[model samples]
Target: MEVTNLVVLPAVLAFFVLCLYFITKVVRLGKHPNLNLPPGRLGWPIVGETFDFMRTMNEGNVLRFIQERVEKYDARVFKTSMFGDPVVVFCGPAGNKFLFSNENKNVQVWWPSSVRKLLRLSLVNKVGDEAKMVRRLLMSFLNAETLRNYLPKMDSIAQRHIDTYWEGKEQVFVYPIVQLYTFELACCLFLSIEDSDHISKLSLKFDEFLKGMIGFPLNIPGTRFHRAMKAADAIRKEIRMILKKRKVDLEEKRASATQDLLSHMLVTSDPSGRFTTEMEIIDNILLLLFAGHDTSRSVLSLVMKYLGQLPHVFEHVLKEQLEISQGKEAGQLLQLEDVQKMKYSWNVASEVMRLSPPVSGAYREAKEDFTYADYNIPKGWKLHWNTGSSHKDPALFSNPETFDASRFEGAGPTPFSYVPFGGGPRMCLGQEFARLEILVFMHNIVKRFKWDLVIPDEKFKYDPMLEPVEGLAIRLHPSHF
Candidate 1:
């Protein structure tokens, strides 16, 4: 009796009290006072619906999760819990519009703990005046005007990539080669690191660096994320060394201010008379290289896949390329006007992005209490918008699964519905750059060969972005033959 009273009784009593506390909290969570929140289940304690959210997305069926809830509730908005936070799902064009238009006013960008931890210098983590300043500086280099100047160089690189990787091959896995091409292109355009040996060494490290950007934030040894963090640190060190040399080049007039992003960063200053630090510039460089290569690589692979599977489309693309080729002399690079003339080719790429967007959605955090879709949204709640729900919605695009590039023919899918490059003030800064790279690659490859996929039944996985489960491999037949 003494033993029971001293230890066991108190232990059991404490356990009961803890259970009672959780029960009370759960009861409180189910009731939101007078606020009319959207209809949905929070699911399980502490963990909430995080596993369901991750599992569905991991399975590459993010749209299914959103569509099911919308169907059952007949509501465009719903409440759910994800990543240990309350999230408000805003579906369709309306949801996209709200998030894109409301940046910094009612909401600002948010990311998972993993991304925030790994990508420390990214502008995505900044807010208010700071974000605006960083964006302006980056835009100075990435805007349409500046990117247009790189078209000839992009054309040259695309031609070289084909000659080096695709020209002599009987069969090749396109994803890896395309990755090498885009990453090398990014290095050339962003850092002017055109030396094959240097770019090759960096590219090997960057593969591991990118894996960390989306991996779990755990920093333990023997983990991919840990390896990623180390790779990121090493890359930063290399960029810093380059920056040191660039400062001398800039000071001595050995490099032009507009030569590369590094030179541009060296000369530019923010609105508040702030010049970026070496570390900050390295972060921006890493961020740009990361974003610039991944999206184009994915899109380029899918472009190859679709063009290969559809013969008529391939003929049309080839015809467009041949027309462009006829005007230019042998070995001459494509001019900006030549790229602009790729209307049909652009439409095809746009359609592929719609079917399998590289970046599906992003997160936002509410600034204050607000009302959306007649539902009360409390402050501090996480906001999410998925392109898949809108892209695959039958109402937005008729026969959404059908591969009709013509769907982008006239004025394209409705506003906010076609967000391959995202939209509004915070839209992808590298959109124009990506366009030039993809169109140039398409032009060069089509004029050379019409390929057929070796793996027709290949699967796509989303490591938060579209990646082929197996690198997309194909066999090429010369277009002239």
Candidate 2:
């Protein structure tokens, strides 16, 4: 009887505690003044609509969740709860402009608790002066000028990647192969981990890490986030091993400070002459891989998908690529000037982004109480944006459903209408890097082979970045063939 009581009592106490937590949140919601806070349901206590949002997103109908609300509420603006905070969503171009323009004034950048937990000390996790300072340091390496020097290296690696992975294969799953390529490139340029075996090991861990990027913040042993946290820790430990060696190498003048991102972070210091701590560098490098790798992979795979479906588009891309290839000899690498000439290919890439943006959008926390579009938004509320809204809005984009690369031909969609990479001051720091990588990838792909997607109308999943459920498989044919 005593043993039974012990088990039952603890269970009852836990249930009671949970009940109280929800009760408190529900009570707080009632106290949350009827302040014209946009029309939307708050869902269950504490969680609010986060589960629904995550579920809808995980299912890959990223726009559907928000669009259902917009259709149910107001097309321009609506309100909801996500990640345990009240959120006001600004829809369309106005939303993009409003949120982006008010980066520091009304709201600031925000990430989910899962992201926060994993990237606590990284640049994206910081705001105000720290964020500015770190962003400046990162941009120094990522900008167009710096990337110009890396172009040939990138071209060489891409060609080698194709030769090693895609050349001998008649058919290959493009997404995974390209993923390996991107991760490998990032390792080479970022950490100087050029060994293929080391990269394969890291890539295995990174795959586990990515699973947690959008999962529930469950830290239990079996959870995705748990596995991801472990993977990140393992990765950081690997980085530390290299960090120690790089320090010795740099001190001996055996490695250039500008050789790779790790070395750059090691040498570059703030106003106080304090270099970033090893942990900070590791965390931010993880963040960079978290941000940079997947977007490029998704874009590359999507480019393949679109080109395969539209032969005319492929022909145009092929012509542009041929011009550049003709300018270079058989084994020569692509130069920055070669990348600059890929205007049409870039346009096609842009169209792919517009149709299926890699990221759905982002979260912003309201810094001050304010009224927007006749709705009262309280302080500490989570403000969010859905780029898909603007990307597919008929009012903002003419025939938004169409895959017309010509849309980017001249003038393009309005200022913030095309926000695949986001907008404003808080825009992606890796924008230039993404451009360089994608254009380089486009150059490599078009010059090498023309391919077709095995699956028609491939379905995509989006924890955040839209990913095809199946790694995009393609039938590769050499340009010479």
Candidate 3:
């Protein structure tokens, strides 16, 4: 054709590049051992879906968006690339069961650098050795017995915040307050930090930490990740100081006077009578403060927002609190026995969790090729299971969108079907702690005030945590206290 060599070479190069791209897609599919994975759209390229995904991150109905993907594509597990990393969204009962298993151990929890860098933990998998030890320690602090011991503290904190902060307020943004209350409780019961001002600043720092968690990982001055890392440093220093103080107090035989989680960790020794090191103490404190406060605050905000709308439920909550408080002293500490009696409140809280999970999506990197139904999940592919999306699935819950609290009245289904705190070995460590906090907060608030929505100009929206992005605004009138 008498074509110039240069023109021919460039055309050949373009053809090869296109060929390599599709060839790689085919190779990825073939790499999976099983070919029976659930069906899904491959689209123009494996990575093209990412831009649309990021665009949808903070827009529209998340539940419907994910649902449509599964339904339209007949996809139980679909692969796409995000930020140059291949990701698969696993859906349906079988896909969820397979992905949820810690036994497979292939799927690594892919926490962002904002959290990982801040906490100095691995960005992927197994949490960190320090973080792991702290998780174990938290079991002791957040266990049933410890929660029982802390009931008085929970009640007192709830009462104090309600009376002092919320008593005279009409409409208020409750998210910040919930966060503050949870941090204060974490300080008293977990970190043993007693100074209100110190705890308040720490709480604000924690909020900043959470804000930075989902962003791209870089420490540029203006980036959220940088601020998060700085926040983490602050928290680490505070933990060190508190630990030193606790050590001093213990040597002085003032241990009897301290009853927080840090105190327990300080006093309790392993089977060999060896004490946990300073790093261990600091790591656990950071873990507990993050898990205990952020998750609880998010859940409580959702619960209160729904409670305000349902006057019938609100009335019953007040009645329930009254019945439980009949014989208790005004300033008495609450016990597991006290929380146990508030069955209705527990159910309400559970329902709220079902409807609005704090941690919306759980992301894991597939360690190896895995198969479910007709779909094949390739190794190293990031897998995201939207628990919030699952919560609203009609297949999983009847009348899924309606705010009905009756679903949890019965014995409940298999744990994975309704996992508000997640499932498997990594299920939330502070679940019981959160339940107690929710019960205490709800009990006191219902007894003291009748809250009404300020009536949004438009429908409210959810942030990453299922908290209202616009902030929870509501009016509260004293309920004949």
Could you give candidate 3's per-residue lDDT for residues 263-373 as a string of tens digits? Answer: 877887665676777776676678678877878888888788888888898777788888888868775667788788888888788788777667756677766776655
- Write down the worst ten-residue block by lDDT for model 2: 214-223
Estimate, for each residue in 1-481, the C-alpha lDDT of model 1 and write its tens digit: 8865765665566456645654665565567688898988777754467777767667766777888888888899998876556788988899999999999999888887667776787787888888888888888888777888888888888878888888878899998889888998999888999888888888888888776665335565556777888998888888889889999988998989999999998898876677898878898898888898988998999999999889899888888888888888877888888989999999999989999887778889989889998889888778988889789888989999998999988787899988877777678888888998899899888878878889898988676668787898899887542
Ordering by TM-score: 2, 1, 3
Which ranges of candidate 1 are over 4 A from the true structure? 1-32
Q: What RMSD does each model have against the real structure?
A: 5.9, 2.9, 7.3
Sorted on lDDT, best first, the list reads: 2, 1, 3
Worst lDDT run of 10 residues, candidate 3, spans 121-130
Q: Rate the local accuracy (lDDT) of all candidates.
A: 0.83, 0.84, 0.70
Model 1: per-residue Cα lDDT at residue 29 = 52
Runs of candidate 3 exceeding 4 Å displacement:
1-57, 104-108, 122-134, 256-258, 267-276, 329-331, 456-463
lDDT of 2 by residue, 88-200 (tens): 88888888999999988898988877888888789878888788888988988998888889888988888889889988688998778888888888888899888999999
